[model samples]
Target: MIKDIPEDKRNTFAAIGLLTVCWASAEYALDFIIRCVHERYGGSQIREAPPVSFKGKPPYLREAFANHPDLAGYLPQLNEFLEEAWQIAEQRHWCIHGSIDLRADASTFPISKIIHGKEHRQDTREFTARQIELLAGRASALSVNLIFFGIQTVRLMPKEEANKLLRELLRKYSAALPEDGPF
Candidate 1:
Protein backbone atom coordinates (compact mmCIF):
# COMPACT_ATOMS: atom_id res chain seq x y z
CA MET A 1 0.00 0.00 0.00
CA ILE A 2 2.81 2.38 0.82
CA LYS A 3 4.52 1.66 -2.45
CA ASP A 4 1.44 2.79 -4.36
CA ILE A 5 1.63 6.29 -2.86
CA PRO A 6 3.51 9.09 -4.63
CA GLU A 7 6.94 9.94 -3.24
CA ASP A 8 6.00 13.52 -2.35
CA LYS A 9 2.93 12.40 -0.45
CA ARG A 10 4.93 9.76 1.36
CA ASN A 11 7.60 12.23 2.30
CA THR A 12 5.07 14.81 3.41
CA PHE A 13 3.28 12.23 5.53
CA ALA A 14 6.51 11.13 7.16
CA ALA A 15 7.56 14.69 7.90
CA ILE A 16 4.20 15.53 9.37
CA GLY A 17 4.24 12.45 11.53
CA LEU A 18 7.71 13.25 12.87
CA LEU A 19 6.80 16.86 13.56
CA THR A 20 3.61 15.83 15.32
CA VAL A 21 5.49 13.52 17.64
CA CYS A 22 8.02 16.23 18.43
CA TRP A 23 5.35 18.85 19.01
CA ALA A 24 3.38 16.50 21.24
CA SER A 25 6.44 15.87 23.36
CA ALA A 26 6.94 19.59 23.88
CA GLU A 27 3.27 20.16 24.64
CA TYR A 28 3.23 17.39 27.19
CA ALA A 29 6.32 18.80 28.88
CA LEU A 30 4.73 22.24 29.05
CA ASP A 31 1.62 20.71 30.58
CA PHE A 32 3.69 18.86 33.14
CA ILE A 33 5.35 22.08 34.27
CA ILE A 34 2.09 23.95 34.43
CA ARG A 35 0.36 21.21 36.41
CA CYS A 36 3.23 20.93 38.84
CA VAL A 37 3.38 24.65 39.49
CA HIS A 38 -0.37 24.81 39.92
CA GLU A 39 -0.63 21.91 42.30
CA ARG A 40 2.33 22.94 44.37
CA TYR A 41 1.23 26.53 44.92
CA GLY A 42 -2.43 26.68 43.95
CA GLY A 43 -3.42 26.00 47.57
CA SER A 44 -6.09 23.62 48.92
CA GLN A 45 -8.90 25.78 47.59
CA ILE A 46 -7.81 25.12 44.00
CA ARG A 47 -8.27 21.42 43.38
CA GLU A 48 -8.24 21.31 39.59
CA ALA A 49 -5.20 21.05 37.34
CA PRO A 50 -4.48 24.19 35.36
CA PRO A 51 -5.73 24.20 31.77
CA VAL A 52 -3.12 23.60 29.12
CA SER A 53 -3.78 23.81 25.39
CA PHE A 54 -2.05 24.78 22.16
CA LYS A 55 -4.08 27.93 21.87
CA GLY A 56 -2.91 30.58 24.34
CA LYS A 57 -0.37 28.19 25.80
CA PRO A 58 2.19 30.91 26.49
CA PRO A 59 -0.30 33.00 28.35
CA TYR A 60 -1.55 30.03 30.27
CA LEU A 61 2.01 29.27 31.30
CA ARG A 62 2.68 32.88 32.27
CA GLU A 63 -0.45 32.99 34.38
CA ALA A 64 0.37 29.69 36.07
CA PHE A 65 3.86 30.85 36.95
CA ALA A 66 2.68 34.27 37.98
CA ASN A 67 0.19 32.84 40.42
CA HIS A 68 3.18 31.65 42.38
CA PRO A 69 5.60 34.45 43.00
CA ASP A 70 8.45 32.12 43.81
CA LEU A 71 8.76 31.13 40.14
CA ALA A 72 9.58 34.70 39.19
CA GLY A 73 13.23 33.86 38.91
CA TYR A 74 12.52 31.39 36.09
CA LEU A 75 10.22 33.74 34.20
CA PRO A 76 12.85 35.12 31.83
CA GLN A 77 13.97 31.68 30.74
CA LEU A 78 10.42 30.48 30.35
CA ASN A 79 9.64 33.54 28.23
CA GLU A 80 12.56 32.82 25.93
CA PHE A 81 11.44 29.23 25.44
CA LEU A 82 7.90 30.37 24.81
CA GLU A 83 9.05 32.72 22.08
CA GLU A 84 10.98 30.00 20.29
CA ALA A 85 8.21 27.48 20.79
CA TRP A 86 5.66 29.90 19.35
CA GLN A 87 7.69 30.26 16.17
CA ILE A 88 7.92 26.50 15.84
CA ALA A 89 4.21 26.25 16.48
CA GLU A 90 3.50 28.59 13.58
CA GLN A 91 5.54 26.48 11.19
CA ARG A 92 3.91 23.32 12.46
CA HIS A 93 0.49 24.93 12.05
CA TRP A 94 1.19 25.81 8.45
CA CYS A 95 2.51 22.36 7.67
CA ILE A 96 -0.54 20.69 9.13
CA HIS A 97 -3.30 23.11 8.18
CA GLY A 98 -2.20 25.07 5.13
CA SER A 99 -2.95 24.07 1.56
CA ILE A 100 0.02 22.29 0.06
CA ASP A 101 1.34 23.13 -3.39
CA LEU A 102 4.14 21.04 -4.74
CA ARG A 103 6.69 22.87 -6.84
CA ALA A 104 7.24 21.81 -10.42
CA ASP A 105 10.72 20.52 -9.57
CA ALA A 106 9.33 18.92 -6.37
CA SER A 107 12.34 20.12 -4.43
CA THR A 108 10.18 22.26 -2.21
CA PHE A 109 6.48 22.69 -1.56
CA PRO A 110 4.65 25.88 -0.74
CA ILE A 111 2.11 25.96 2.07
CA SER A 112 -0.46 28.76 2.09
CA LYS A 113 -2.81 29.91 4.80
CA ILE A 114 -5.46 32.63 4.59
CA ILE A 115 -6.61 34.40 7.70
CA HIS A 116 -10.15 35.75 7.75
CA GLY A 117 -9.87 37.65 10.97
CA LYS A 118 -10.17 41.38 11.74
CA GLU A 119 -7.89 42.01 8.81
CA HIS A 120 -7.44 39.68 5.89
CA ARG A 121 -4.00 38.08 5.90
CA GLN A 122 -2.40 35.73 3.42
CA ASP A 123 0.63 33.62 4.33
CA THR A 124 2.53 31.43 1.91
CA ARG A 125 5.89 29.81 2.42
CA GLU A 126 7.97 27.18 0.72
CA PHE A 127 9.39 24.39 2.80
CA THR A 128 11.96 21.73 2.07
CA ALA A 129 12.13 18.37 3.80
CA ARG A 130 15.37 19.50 5.41
CA GLN A 131 13.69 22.56 6.89
CA ILE A 132 10.91 20.47 8.34
CA GLU A 133 13.45 18.10 9.84
CA LEU A 134 15.24 21.01 11.49
CA LEU A 135 11.98 22.28 12.94
CA ALA A 136 11.28 18.83 14.35
CA GLY A 137 14.70 18.73 15.95
CA ARG A 138 14.09 22.11 17.56
CA ALA A 139 10.74 20.97 18.93
CA SER A 140 12.37 17.88 20.36
CA ALA A 141 15.03 19.95 22.07
CA LEU A 142 12.41 22.33 23.41
CA SER A 143 10.67 19.39 25.03
CA VAL A 144 13.81 18.24 26.79
CA ASN A 145 14.66 21.72 28.01
CA LEU A 146 11.14 22.20 29.27
CA ILE A 147 11.43 19.05 31.33
CA PHE A 148 14.63 20.40 32.79
CA PHE A 149 12.90 23.65 33.59
CA GLY A 150 10.17 21.73 35.38
CA ILE A 151 12.64 19.80 37.51
CA GLN A 152 14.02 23.10 38.66
CA THR A 153 10.60 24.15 39.74
CA VAL A 154 7.99 22.14 41.93
CA ARG A 155 9.86 23.08 45.08
CA LEU A 156 9.77 19.40 46.02
CA MET A 157 13.54 19.63 46.19
CA PRO A 158 15.61 21.89 48.34
CA LYS A 159 17.21 24.80 46.49
CA GLU A 160 20.45 22.88 46.16
CA GLU A 161 18.82 19.80 44.64
CA ALA A 162 16.91 21.88 42.15
CA ASN A 163 20.00 23.69 40.89
CA LYS A 164 22.03 20.46 40.96
CA LEU A 165 19.58 18.63 38.70
CA LEU A 166 19.37 21.63 36.37
CA ARG A 167 23.14 21.73 36.06
CA GLU A 168 23.29 18.01 35.36
CA LEU A 169 20.61 18.28 32.71
CA LEU A 170 22.40 21.16 30.98
CA ARG A 171 25.73 19.34 31.09
CA LYS A 172 24.22 16.13 29.74
CA TYR A 173 22.34 17.82 26.90
CA SER A 174 24.78 20.63 26.26
CA ALA A 175 24.54 20.38 22.52
CA ALA A 176 20.78 19.91 22.43
CA LEU A 177 19.98 22.85 24.65
CA PRO A 178 20.11 26.26 22.98
CA GLU A 179 23.00 28.52 23.92
CA ASP A 180 20.55 31.14 25.19
CA GLY A 181 18.86 28.66 27.49
CA PRO A 182 19.19 29.31 31.21
CA PHE A 183 22.09 27.44 32.79
Candidate 2:
Protein backbone atom coordinates (compact mmCIF):
# COMPACT_ATOMS: atom_id res chain seq x y z
CA MET A 1 0.00 0.00 0.00
CA ILE A 2 2.86 2.40 0.86
CA LYS A 3 4.65 1.68 -2.41
CA ASP A 4 1.65 2.93 -4.41
CA ILE A 5 1.83 6.44 -2.86
CA PRO A 6 3.77 9.25 -4.62
CA GLU A 7 7.14 10.28 -3.13
CA ASP A 8 6.17 13.94 -2.82
CA LYS A 9 3.01 13.13 -0.91
CA ARG A 10 4.94 10.86 1.45
CA ASN A 11 7.47 13.59 2.10
CA THR A 12 4.70 16.11 2.76
CA PHE A 13 3.10 13.83 5.32
CA ALA A 14 6.44 13.34 7.09
CA ALA A 15 7.10 17.10 7.19
CA ILE A 16 3.67 17.76 8.67
CA GLY A 17 4.24 15.16 11.37
CA LEU A 18 7.61 16.62 12.31
CA LEU A 19 6.14 20.13 12.48
CA THR A 20 3.37 18.91 14.77
CA VAL A 21 5.90 17.42 17.17
CA CYS A 22 8.02 20.59 17.19
CA TRP A 23 4.98 22.76 17.89
CA ALA A 24 3.88 20.48 20.70
CA SER A 25 7.28 20.53 22.38
CA ALA A 26 7.64 24.29 22.09
CA GLU A 27 4.18 24.85 23.53
CA TYR A 28 4.84 22.54 26.45
CA ALA A 29 7.95 24.47 27.45
CA LEU A 30 6.13 27.80 27.23
CA ASP A 31 3.22 26.49 29.26
CA PHE A 32 5.50 25.17 31.99
CA ILE A 33 7.31 28.51 32.37
CA ILE A 34 4.06 30.47 32.48
CA ARG A 35 2.55 28.16 35.06
CA CYS A 36 5.62 28.43 37.27
CA VAL A 37 5.47 32.21 37.26
CA HIS A 38 1.74 32.25 37.86
CA GLU A 39 1.95 29.85 40.77
CA ARG A 40 4.87 31.64 42.40
CA TYR A 41 2.90 34.87 42.44
CA GLY A 42 -0.56 33.54 43.33
CA GLY A 43 0.60 32.57 46.87
CA SER A 44 -1.72 29.57 46.95
CA GLN A 45 1.06 27.33 48.34
CA ILE A 46 -0.22 24.56 46.09
CA ARG A 47 1.26 23.95 42.64
CA GLU A 48 -0.90 23.16 39.62
CA ALA A 49 0.17 21.29 36.53
CA PRO A 50 0.51 23.06 33.19
CA PRO A 51 -2.27 22.78 30.60
CA VAL A 52 -2.33 19.43 28.80
CA SER A 53 -3.14 20.94 25.41
CA PHE A 54 -3.37 24.25 23.65
CA LYS A 55 -6.32 25.22 21.44
CA GLY A 56 -6.48 27.21 18.15
CA LYS A 57 -3.92 27.79 15.43
CA PRO A 58 -0.35 27.89 16.82
CA PRO A 59 -1.89 27.36 20.22
CA TYR A 60 1.21 27.25 22.41
CA LEU A 61 2.77 30.38 20.94
CA ARG A 62 -0.58 32.13 21.11
CA GLU A 63 -1.06 31.13 24.76
CA ALA A 64 2.36 32.46 25.73
CA PHE A 65 1.49 35.83 24.19
CA ALA A 66 -2.03 35.86 25.55
CA ASN A 67 -1.11 35.27 29.20
CA HIS A 68 1.08 38.35 29.45
CA PRO A 69 -1.23 41.31 29.71
CA ASP A 70 1.41 43.50 31.34
CA LEU A 71 3.49 43.31 28.19
CA ALA A 72 0.67 44.57 25.99
CA GLY A 73 2.78 47.56 24.94
CA TYR A 74 5.36 45.23 23.41
CA LEU A 75 2.88 42.92 21.68
CA PRO A 76 3.67 44.13 18.16
CA GLN A 77 7.37 43.33 18.48
CA LEU A 78 6.72 40.04 20.24
CA ASN A 79 4.26 38.89 17.58
CA GLU A 80 6.68 39.74 14.79
CA PHE A 81 9.47 37.77 16.48
CA LEU A 82 7.32 34.69 17.17
CA GLU A 83 5.99 34.66 13.58
CA GLU A 84 9.53 34.67 12.19
CA ALA A 85 10.63 31.97 14.62
CA TRP A 86 7.68 29.78 13.63
CA GLN A 87 8.59 30.18 9.96
CA ILE A 88 12.18 29.16 10.63
CA ALA A 89 11.10 26.16 12.68
CA GLU A 90 8.71 25.13 9.89
CA GLN A 91 11.51 25.38 7.32
CA ARG A 92 13.79 23.26 9.51
CA HIS A 93 11.02 20.71 9.92
CA TRP A 94 10.63 20.46 6.15
CA CYS A 95 14.36 20.15 5.59
CA ILE A 96 14.67 17.36 8.12
CA HIS A 97 11.55 15.31 7.34
CA GLY A 98 11.09 15.88 3.59
CA SER A 99 13.39 14.41 0.95
CA ILE A 100 15.35 16.89 -1.16
CA ASP A 101 16.05 15.57 -4.65
CA LEU A 102 19.42 17.15 -5.40
CA ARG A 103 19.57 15.20 -8.67
CA ALA A 104 16.19 16.60 -9.79
CA ASP A 105 15.66 19.46 -12.26
CA ALA A 106 16.24 21.97 -9.43
CA SER A 107 20.02 22.21 -9.41
CA THR A 108 21.81 22.54 -6.08
CA PHE A 109 24.04 25.61 -5.88
CA PRO A 110 26.87 26.24 -3.45
CA ILE A 111 26.19 28.78 -0.67
CA SER A 112 28.87 31.20 -1.91
CA LYS A 113 27.74 31.01 -5.54
CA ILE A 114 24.11 31.69 -4.72
CA ILE A 115 24.98 34.89 -2.79
CA HIS A 116 27.50 36.13 -5.40
CA GLY A 117 25.13 35.42 -8.27
CA LYS A 118 22.86 38.10 -9.77
CA GLU A 119 19.73 36.36 -8.48
CA HIS A 120 20.51 34.89 -5.09
CA ARG A 121 18.75 31.93 -3.53
CA GLN A 122 15.41 33.10 -2.14
CA ASP A 123 16.17 31.53 1.24
CA THR A 124 19.80 31.81 2.30
CA ARG A 125 21.40 30.36 5.43
CA GLU A 126 22.57 33.83 6.49
CA PHE A 127 19.02 35.16 6.40
CA THR A 128 17.82 32.30 8.55
CA ALA A 129 20.66 32.87 11.04
CA ARG A 130 19.68 36.52 11.39
CA GLN A 131 16.05 35.57 11.93
CA ILE A 132 17.11 33.17 14.69
CA GLU A 133 19.14 35.89 16.35
CA LEU A 134 16.16 38.23 16.32
CA LEU A 135 14.03 35.48 17.75
CA ALA A 136 16.49 35.04 20.63
CA GLY A 137 16.28 38.75 21.43
CA ARG A 138 12.50 38.54 21.46
CA ALA A 139 12.66 35.53 23.73
CA SER A 140 14.87 37.48 26.13
CA ALA A 141 12.33 40.31 26.09
CA LEU A 142 9.60 37.84 26.95
CA SER A 143 11.65 36.50 29.85
CA VAL A 144 12.14 39.99 31.19
CA ASN A 145 8.43 40.67 30.85
CA LEU A 146 7.66 37.52 32.82
CA ILE A 147 10.02 38.60 35.58
CA PHE A 148 8.25 41.92 35.82
CA PHE A 149 4.86 40.24 36.01
CA GLY A 150 6.04 37.90 38.72
CA ILE A 151 7.42 40.74 40.80
CA GLN A 152 4.21 42.74 40.50
CA THR A 153 1.88 39.87 41.24
CA VAL A 154 3.94 38.71 44.19
CA ARG A 155 3.99 42.27 45.55
CA LEU A 156 7.76 42.30 45.54
CA MET A 157 7.43 45.73 43.95
CA PRO A 158 4.65 48.09 42.85
CA LYS A 159 3.74 48.04 39.15
CA GLU A 160 5.06 51.50 38.19
CA GLU A 161 8.26 51.07 40.15
CA ALA A 162 8.73 47.49 38.93
CA ASN A 163 8.48 48.61 35.31
CA LYS A 164 11.10 51.28 35.90
CA LEU A 165 13.48 48.84 37.58
CA LEU A 166 12.89 46.22 34.97
CA ARG A 167 13.85 48.61 32.19
CA GLU A 168 17.00 49.55 34.05
CA LEU A 169 17.93 45.91 34.59
CA LEU A 170 17.31 45.14 30.91
CA ARG A 171 19.58 47.96 29.84
CA LYS A 172 22.33 46.85 32.17
CA TYR A 173 22.07 43.22 31.13
CA SER A 174 21.94 43.98 27.41
CA ALA A 175 25.05 46.20 27.41
CA ALA A 176 28.49 44.70 26.78
CA LEU A 177 30.64 44.34 29.86
CA PRO A 178 34.24 45.53 29.94
CA GLU A 179 36.92 42.92 30.45
CA ASP A 180 38.51 43.09 33.91
CA GLY A 181 41.70 41.27 34.95
CA PRO A 182 41.46 37.52 34.27
CA PHE A 183 40.64 35.36 37.28
- Please tell me which predicted candidate would have the highest TM-score against the true structure: 1
Best by lDDT: 1
- Writing each residue's lDDT as its tens digit, candidate 1 over 1-183 gives 889867876787688779989999998988777666666766323435466457756876776666668887778898998998999998999998888875445868888999789989988888877788889999999998887777766643455655565667668876343443343
List candidate 1 stretches off by more than 4 Å: 43-49, 120-122, 155-183
Q: Write the per-residue lDDT of candidate 2 for residues 1-183, one digit (tens) a residue.
A: 667756644544354454455554554444544464345433122224434543322343344445555434545654664565466455444344344443332222112212237865434221222333444444445444434433433343455665565556657879532233111
Model 2: what TM-score?
A: 0.33
Name the runs in model 2 displaced over 4 angstroms: 1-58, 102-183
Q: Worst ten-residue run, lDDT, model 2? A: 105-114
Clashes of 1: 0
Alpha-carbon RMSD, each predicted model = 5.5, 13.7
